[model samples]
Every structure is written in structure tokens, then in C-alpha cells.
Target chain A: MTEKSPGLFGRLKAGLGRTRAKLGGSLATLIVGRKAIDAELIEELEALLLGADIGIEATGVLIGDLESRLSRNALRDGDAVYAALREGMLGILQGGETTLELPSRGKPNLIMLVGVNGAGKTTTAGKLARQLQDQGRSVMLAAADTFRAAAVEQLQSWGERNRIPVIAQHSGADPAAVVFDAMSAAAARGLDVVIADTSGRLHTQGNLMAELTKIARVARKADPEAPAECLLVLDAGVGQNGLAQAEQFGQAVGLTGVVLTKLDGTARGGVIFAIRKKLDLPVKYIGVGESIDDLRPFDPEAFVDALLSGEA
Target chain B: MFTGLSERLAESFKKLQGRGLLSEENIQQALRDVRVALLEADVALPVVRQFLEQVKERALGREVVKSLTPDQAFIKIVNDELVALMGGQSEGLNLTGDSPSVVLVAGLQGAGKTTTVGKLARWLMQTQGLRVMLSSGDIYRPAAIEQLRLLAEQVGAGFYQADTGSSPVAIAQAAVEAAQRNQADVLLFDSAGRLHVDDAMMGEIKQLHAVLKPTETLFVVDSMTGQDAANTAKAFDVALPLSGVVLTKMDGDARGGAALSVRQITGKPIKFFGTGEKLDALEVFHPDRIVSRILGMGDVVSLVEKVERTVDHEQAEKLARKVKRGKGFDLDDFRQQIGMLNSMGGLGSMMKMLPGMPNVGAEASAAGAREMRRIEAIINSMTAAERHKPEIIKGSRKRRIASGSGTQVQDVNRLLKQFIQMQKMMKKAGKRGGMAGLMRGMGGKLPPGARF
Candidate 1:
């Protein structure tokens, strides 16, 4: 296993190595030789932004901003484009809250994790639960994902390994019923936090996604202010479709924050801007790797630095 | 999955439909639209640029005819390029050489790597009639091995458990030895997925690749990922001798840019696709059907194949005969039709094949799916006598069904009216011929305002 790098920014830089190579390095080379800011540079920079999966709407906004700056005689050289691009990216991500704000002291802060299938919702729930536990808060897990094969067992395995109590029903049970049970269990145990792992099979129209809303509604029965946070776990590679998922899930169950997983891979994580700009939801954390402690709080400045910090 | 692209291209071609000749400016304009579509679909920027360049050259130099519309010609050029970009035909696993052919599955984390292993194992065993064995090299996750073991047990594949204390290379080598001893026809190694492609993980995979000398090394990726899929596949291709690709989770709302981009970027064929989470959902990648589907032409062949595989022929023939004899279609028939649709990957997938419905967005499809489920639930809640005799179902019965199906009373009334209309249409077509006539008759009833 790779040890955690001492610096958070260093770990982030390493994690974003692929995106840096494709977007940052390419952008630097495209602009390095050119003295004047021209159509070619703008076009190549546009390509770079789109290549990073910065998305059409956001890229258009960034390029438009750069073009306006260019027209105003604000642009000087290649380094200017690089700085402008960094600043443009940061502008979108900066609006969202970087740190996870827990609910008022004594009560258990409930966070219902949601996303499409294979978006790392379960793993993120487990990691977040463990993180809260390590921070001296008593944490319990709700295995609300009883549909998928081995899903309940996966959550239970995390609970057992981390020594956190997991409230779960047998496989094929109603997920809402499972969360209800977990809520009761958490209240009885006097746990400080309850992280519910909701089903990610939102594409299944009828009962699977309906169960998420039901879980949220029932969680309130346990505590009026329950489910203090609803985090949508998005895979970094989800591209523009992440917007659709966020919109759908956000509208269905109000999203408090977003968790982008698999960020350490080839995904440029450009969807971060799209999610922030479109949904206006803060990215609470990013999953850097498979390790338990790899879950890091989202730091927009650090993330932007890691993303565009490439030498020509 | 490529609905967005198809719709954008449709719009672009509509602009060119007025023109007779393929002018350079018109071609460039349409190519620009194609470029945007590809970029939006998540095809890498560079690939999209190059693809549009080739398309531009071809479209400008094309020989136009009197019969073909300008739009049709443009679509043909685009379709041909798409088919060429993907490896032109379906490429299955190359497992002829080794007795226990080794297939190494590698990908980033949460890219459906482990699930693909199980699906591929099941597909090989059920479809190819091969004895399959499964092994997991993902020692990082505590339950990774257990998850694969359970999947193997569920699928009835041979399981070669790796020692958790051992390195990935050691585990893979031991699994290969066990597979040989067990006389398995195929051994699938499920390697660990790093959150990112780090040197350590790549080095580990490289070592495993050296020892296994696998027949095929498949890079599994999530289809929802846009340009990243191509980039990631290219990165992996640089380090390993990749045999092919596996695009997973086609069941999701992915625009399917990865399907278009990965092939051109990696220069490898996509061997299989994971349509759903089920073990039987793995399918051979068919380039022609995909190209047609992407071009908004609809994949009739795949649609027909799906029907043939899932629909009961004898039952269908019996129903056709019954309808021909003037016997009315009932709730039971309705249930069976809905069940058949469910079996053929549900309404969303079916809509992708029907003409003029390729670009059905997620919300509309979700509604369609919900409607299917509601109708099925209502039918299940019906009594045998009520199902057979709709005349016996009055207001009270309708209420009961509505409550039972968790739907409104209007829903029951709507369904019954729709059923009556369908019976009338089926009877009218039954006089002409069999089910083909029924489909043709139904097509004729589509609104005049409907556009392809």
C-alpha cells in the first residue's frame, strides 16, 4: 500500500497526474511557442478544456471570459492563458463550501449517501463513517442498500472491520425498512452519527429510487432534523452525465453536498465545475484512492493547483 | 447512449436538407456540429478533431446522387466513418490457443472491474460452454476476495482463492496453477483498481501480465465516463499489451462517448459490453448495430435478436392465432406482453430501437419505465375472472385495482381504454396477416407530426 504523502497538496498533485498530463501539459505546450494571443491559441485552449471534460457550457464560459480578456488587451503571453484558465476553474469551484460542517453538537448527524450504480457510494459511506469514528465521534452505519447482491454484506464488512455497529436487514428486504431500523438502533445506542448507504440503482424506475425518498422521509420519523446531509457520490469519469444524475437526485432528494470518487485515476475531474456551476452544491470530499483514509475534504484552491500545476 | 449525438447530428443535417449539392461550406458547418456532438458525448478532444477532419475531407469529396438527400448523404458518410472508427465488426475473445485461456481484467476503481469478471466468467460458461474459474488480485479491499468468491459460487464457476497476505503477482500466478490443475477452460484474474493510475498499481499489473501471458487483457470502463474512458484506456494501453476493451453499465444514462472514443484511441476492438449487473448481461460488441443506433437509424437487428431470445415463440404464435380467431386480448395477454418487454431489457432499451425515438431523454424513459411497472402491477392485482372478462370490471373493481397497483383510478381507466384500442388495432391488422402486419398497422397509426 502506498503511504499517505505528508502534504495534502502533494497527495492531490500525485492523484491528478493523469489530468495534468493531458490538460495542463498539453495547454502549456500549445501556448509556449506563441508570443501573441491568437485564434489558434484560443482554439487549442478550448480543445484542452473540452478534452478535460470541463464540459461544453463551462468551457464556453471560460473561453468567452478569456476572449473578452484578450479583447481588452489584458492578455500578454502563453503564461497569461495558463493563469487565466486556472483562475477560471477556481472561480467555479470556489463558491461551494470546502469543509464538511457537522450538525449541532450532541445529536447524531445523518448523511444519506446517494448516486448511480458503481459510483462508489457504499465505499464512500464506509470511508466517511470511519473518518467520523477516527475523529472521536461515535458512528453507526445503516445498510440501506439491500437490493444488489453482496451490497449489504459489503457494508457490514466495513462496519465489522472498523468496529462500528451496522444496522441492516437481510438481503431483499425493503430498504426503507432497513433505514427505519437503523434510525431506531442509532437512537437507542446514542451514537453521534448515522451514515446511511442508500441504493445507487436510481435508473431502476419504480421501487429502487422510490425507496431512497422513502428512506429520507422515514429517517425524519426517527428524528425531525434527521438526514442533516445528503451527499451524491459521483464517479470522476461520469463526464457530462454527472449533471443529469445530480439534477435528478438533487430534485428527488435535496442534495446537501457532492462526493467525487475515483479522482486518483484518469478522470480529469472537470465535472467538478459543472456540478458546482449547475447544481450549486459544494463538493464535500474526494476519494483519492481505495484506502480508508484516502477520502479528503474538498479544497478548491488545492484542487485547481493540482489540476493545472504542470511544467512546460 | 448516443442519443444526444444523434439529436445534434439530426439538427445539423436538417439544416443541410435544403441543399442539393455538398458544398464545402455546408459540409464544414455540418462537420462543426458533428465535432460539438462528439465532444459533448465525451470523445476526447483530439480524437473528435481528427474524426471531424476525416469526415470533412470525405463529405466534400463525395459523389452525390439524385435519389439521396443531402442530409442522407451526410448521414451515410458519418455512419461509415463511425463504423470504421469502431473495429467494423464484432470481435469476440481470442481464446483458441491455451486450454485454460487467461483473461486479465484491469481498470480504475469503481469502473465495474470486479463485476465484469463475474459477468465474463458467466458469459463464457453459459454462452461458450466453457469451464470457467475466477480469481481476485484486489487485495486492498477487505471484502474484494469474498465478493468474487460469492460471485463465483453464484455463477457456479471454479474459485481459486488467493492468500490475502500474498502480493498480487503471487496470487495471480497461484490462481493460474490452480486453474490448470482443475482443468478449467478459462481463468479470469480480477486485478485491483487504483483510484488513479499510479506507478505502483501499473507496475503490479505489468508483473501479473508478464507471468500470466493471458490470451486477452480487457480494460473494463464505465460508459458514463465521457472522454476519460479513452484517455484511461490509452494510458493502460501504453503500459500493457491490451487485447480489447469492455464498456460496462450500458444500462445507465451514459451518452456512450467512451464506446466511440476508446476504439479509435486505443486501436483495439471492444470485445464485450456489460449491459446490466446480471451475470447474463455481458454481450459481444457489435459495431454495425452500434453505428446504426448512434446514427438514429435504430438497431432493428439487435431489437429482433432481443425479441427472439426473450419472447416465447410458441406463446406468441398462440396469441396471434387467438387474435386471428377474433378472441379478445385480455389482462393475461397484457401481462405477458409487459413481461416480454421486461425480458427484452425493458422499455428504455426497446425505445432505442424503434424508429424516431432514439433520443428519448432520461426523464421520459424513466416515466416510460414507471408506466410499465404500474401497468404490470395493476395486471397482477387482477382476479383471473376479472382479467378474462373486462366487461365484469366496473367502477368498484377499477378502484380496487387502482389501490392495489398503488396507482390512481384514472390509470386503470386509461389502461383499459388503451387495451380496447389495441384490440381494435390488432383485429384490423389480423385480417391482413400475422404479427408483422400488426406492427406495420401500429406504425401507420403514429401521429403525422412525428419526426425521425
Candidate 2:
């Protein structure tokens, strides 16, 4: 339901050349010479899926479905097998919410970005804020990530670059208080959205996670529906542990959705399938690289095709 | 380290364990289990295949030890192959050159390069007792240099500020000169995080590398990076003569399968692990420990080593002696004990090392740490009289201490009860022997107060 540039598939295909060789291109080889979906072809498909980091559990489910179909004499060729695989992934990825539903009140939609360390929460915060602003939402930035050194300045710089208002405190200030203050100020200023960039914390840190839930709770005092959207910012390159990250963050802050970043390289961002299988959160956005232009709404069709980009 | 349902792997190897030598069919079944384990652990598919092939070659028709099961013998072989691939033991920085040895830290964006740079500075300053300087060649990322400056200040290291708008090469040159002028023993140059596929950025790093001629070009990679870690590690190694890899964010739930991917691809030792957020949270990379972890077989040797390294033996002995002399264990001593627990990388770092450690995510350890911090805070709020003689902590004193510590009266009461148990346990352990006996006996099982 968001902007879809035509360059996405082409860019993703070019950037994901290595992954094509690892997953799609090799599978292309398997398909071109194959007579039918045999055991060896099925095995190669299994390896390709696993190689893409779609993870073992989801891969197992997909493979089991294929085997069951084969046993039932479905008589599927290699193309049918590939389409079935794509459809299976799309079954998991197709319907996730690409946008948040803001409340009717004039209160700002507080989108709190949370995730484990180095998942690019702060960077994604800036890009998402800019994207929302570009979409006619009067966006403001909040720097609640006071723990990391110079984190406030990072968000502040992003705001300065965008010519947007940023609410922040000195390093080591209580993050919840900063989040609340930013929310209330945004509401007072009648901003459409206030994106709060939270400090990256390991989901394993229970007390810190509790602090996040606290932040989510106290923001309601600023605006009744504050923190309307809590997005878990995840790195596309993260492995199977992305599931744990999504689960813990969702449990702690009740994340409304997830945003996968750093999709510019060979990392296929396949962990989202596993994550969606476990925790049924929608994919809100996907970031290609550090640039602001790289952030866009998640398009499952484009993503699935991008993975299998090279085909006759 | 392994996912649930991975109990022993012995059930699948029934025939292998029954006969001392494993049959090919049985070995294939066990290898299937191991293969699934590695895949679930998130090792790259190709790397997993390579690793399984080696394990198969070693485990095929291999005789098991009399005391060991077939699965255990096979796992031992798998663990050895992983360990040997990673490098046999802990490796430190190769800073054997003259003064102001340079180390360039590079990695993908958000892989914790800047934070690891801070931790590395603190590690160099403290462990080696060397004067260190920090500089950031990360001009592209906003506030990156400021982050390094703040970190340098936090770790008590000299910071070399590059001129405004200077290129990375100029920054490296200036940083080296400043280090020479300051007579700093080592200069850690933190570069901007760049994807290996970014040719321009890679080229820029190559130029910076030429300028620095770093004694160590450590690739700081996220432990959670999956199959892409191999491609990126190989690309970076090709772009630069990477001396080693520094796996960052190890304190998280990531199974660290990227450790194998990076090591196998780069053929470089992983030098350090940036364990936690703290500047002193860096740990020397231990291969056997990581191998056991990846293989889902925990060994107590590394745990004991960690305990020995972090635990203050002198303070622990003094506390025991005081308890023996009829001086009761006070709140202050309890606080010190909690501090010791924190210094030992908190509960999760230690918990993951125990053999047969159930899939206790870092949350359990974090909860224990939270409870310990609460106890410490409560003790801090207590009056000296109440702390020294907790018996005098009546209802009013309990309320006052609870309010001061921002805790409820019931929390205070629970702390007091758990403290009493700990006190009794300490007394019994004290009479039994020295701190070593108490540590070994009580270390695995933390005091009730610490366990929430």
C-alpha cells in the first residue's frame, strides 16, 4: 500500500547476485536440465532454501509439503515445484501489514523502533521518519537512545539533515522519560507521527526489556494511544536467532510489526519467513542500505521474485 | 546452544553406541542429526556441508572410547574440527611492532564496530597497562567520530580528532602522527562500517589500510550474521590482509554460527568477543569453548577459567575468614558478592557454559542479574547499623530501606529471608574450607537472593 519503484527488482537482483548463485541461480541450473521434480532436485531445492537463510524450520515445512505432494503423485515439473516454493513463501509473507493504523485523535502516532544491538534501529528510525514525512505525515524525531555514546547526536544529525524537529536529552537520561516527552510534545505540536529511536538492547537483557515495556506503558500517559506502532528493527543478515529477537521484543514491547534493514548485499533477508512463522507480526518496511531512499514498504511479491530473479 | 529436542543425539546413534565402532549407516544417521543441528545453529549451508564432511571423514569407522558413547565420540570429532578451523586457542592482537601500533576495525553497518572499538581501547589500556589512543575514520556515519570520542573518554584513552571533513586516509595519517606525538603505545583506528559489496567504500578502506599499515586489521562482524558472513568475510579478506575477526554482540542469543563461517572463509583467528555493552566487556576469543557451544556440548573448563579470571580471590578469602572469626556476613559482603557475579559476565555468560544447559535464553540470567542489582540497591539504601546487623531491620527500618531503594516492603522482606539463607550457607561453607571450596560448591548454584 506504499510506494513501489520499478527499480526495486532490478536493484535487488544486481545487489543479490551472490545470493542468486547461492539460491536462485543454482536452482535455475537444477531446473533447466531436470526432467521432473525428483528426489535429487528436491534435495537441491532444500539446500538452496537453507542456503538463503530461510532457516531450518521453515525449510523443513516447505520440504515436507513438497515430499507429501510428490508422494500423492502431483506430477509437478521443476517450474511447478519452483512456483509452489514461491507460493509457500508468499503464503507466509504476502499479507503482512505495510502501514500502521493511526488513531482518530489528533495525537501523534508514536512509532517506537526497538530491537537487539546493532540491528540498525537508529538509522531505520531516521529513514522511516523521513519516509513518513514524505508521505504527508508531519513527522518528528525523538532520540530516546541515551545509553549509547553520541546516540542522541546521531538522531539529532538525522533530524538536522531532514530539517525536522527532534526531541532529545543528554546522554544517560531515562529513555522512557524522553520517549514520553517527545510524544507529548509531538501531540501538542499536532505532528502526525513521532518516531522514537530507542537504544538497541539485547532481547536477552530482561531488565532492559522490562524498561522497554515501561517506555511503551508510560508513553500512553502522554497521548492515550501513544506508541501506536512498535516496530522491531532487524538486520537482514541476522540468522535463525532473528526469531528469538522478534519473539522477545514482541513479548516485551508488544511490537506491532518488524522492519528488516541492510538488504543491500548478498544477505537474502530470509529469516523473516522463519520469524513470521513463529511470531505473526507484519513486515512494515525493508531497508536496502544506509541511504534514506533505500527504505520502502515491504513488498512480498518483489522480495520473492528478487530471490529468484535470474530465470529464463 | 542447541535447539530443544536435541537431547544427547545418542538416541539416533543407538547402533553406533552399541558397537564401539560406528557403522556407515548409523554414522550417516548421526551425521544427519549433526547436520540439522549446525543448520539450526545458522551456519552457512556450504560451510555446514564442509564441516559435516570433515566430521564424517573423522567419525567414519572410528572407535569410540570405552567410557564414552558413540555420539559423544562423534561430537568430539566434530567439535575438534570446528575448533581447529577457528584456531586452537585464544589469540590476542598482533601488536608486536614498534610504538603506536595501529589496528583498523571494519565491519558492516550496525555490526557493532564502533562499540567494539571502545571495548578494545579499554581492553588494551587495562590488560596491557599500555597508553592507548583512539581515532575514528568513520566520517560518513553521523556522530560516529563523536561516538568514538565519547568512548575514548569513557575508557580513559587519548583521542585523536581528525580535522573536519578530512578523508579516511587523512584521518589515519593524522591519527598515527598524533599517537606518535602522544607516545601512545597503541592507536586503535575505527573505520566506518561498509558492506563488502560497496566497491567505492572497499576501495577507500584499502587506501586507509595502506596509510595505516596496521599491525592488526581486525574485521568486526556480528555473531548473528548468517550465510552472508562467509561471502562478506571472504570479500573483506580479499580487499585487505585481514589479520583476524572480532565477533561482536556475543552476549545476545545469537548462536554465533558466523564464527565458523568467518573463520573458515578468512582463515583468520577470531581474536576477541565484545560480550556486552560495558567497555570492559571484551573477552579473548576461546575456540574450544565456542566449538563446544556450536556442537551443543558445554564444557566446564572455560567456565572455571572465567570464574578464576574475574573472581577476586583476595576479597573472597577475606570474606570467608571474617565469617569464620564469628563476624557475621553483612549486607556489604553480600553486595560485594553480587558485584563478583556481575564481573563474571553476569549470569547468562556463565549459564551458557554449564554442560546440559537447557535452552535458558539470556533472559533467565538477566532476571538473576536484575534481582542481584535490586538486592545491592536495597543494601545500599540501608543504614550501616541495619546493614551490619540485619536483625535490627524491623518493620519501620524495612519500610524506610524499601522506600529508599524504590522497592516494596515485600521485596525487602524477601531479600532479608534469602539473605538469611545465604548467610547460613556461607557459614557452613566457610567452616568446610577456604573460598575455593565455597566457590566450587556454591558457584554453579547462585544464592537464592540472586536467583529470582
Name the lDDT value of residue B168 in candidate 2.
Answer: 88
Worst 10 residues of 1 chain B by lDDT: B443-452
Model 2 lDDT tens row, A1-312: 122222223356344433333344455677644566778888877877787788888989988988887788773577667767778888988775678776557778888999988888888888877887787888899898999999999999999988899999888898999988888788788888889999899987767998999998899887777678999998888988889889888888888888988777777778899888888888888887666888878878778867655321
Query: Residue-wise lDDT of candidate 2 within B1-452, one digit each (tens)?
Result: 33222333433444346565566777887888867766776777788889878887887643454426666677677667877888877779888888889999988888899899899888888888989999999998889999999999998999999789898889899899999999999999999988777778888999999999999999999988887887789889999999999998887767777888898888999999887898877888888766666545665887788787788889877776866653567887777877887877676666667776634555566577777778788999998888889999999998899999999999999888877877766666667667664574346336454443
Find the 10 residues in a row with the least total lDDT in model 2 chain A. Answer: A1-10
Q: What is the lDDT of residue B138 in candidate 1?
A: 85
Strongest candidate by lDDT: 2
Each candidate's DockQ: 0.49, 0.48
TM-score of each model, paired residue for residue: 0.90, 0.87
Clashing pairs in 1: A264-B196, A265-B195, A265-B196
Residues B180-268, candidate 1: write the lDDT tens digits. Answer: 99999999999988533576777788999999889999988888887677667777999889999999888766678888788888898
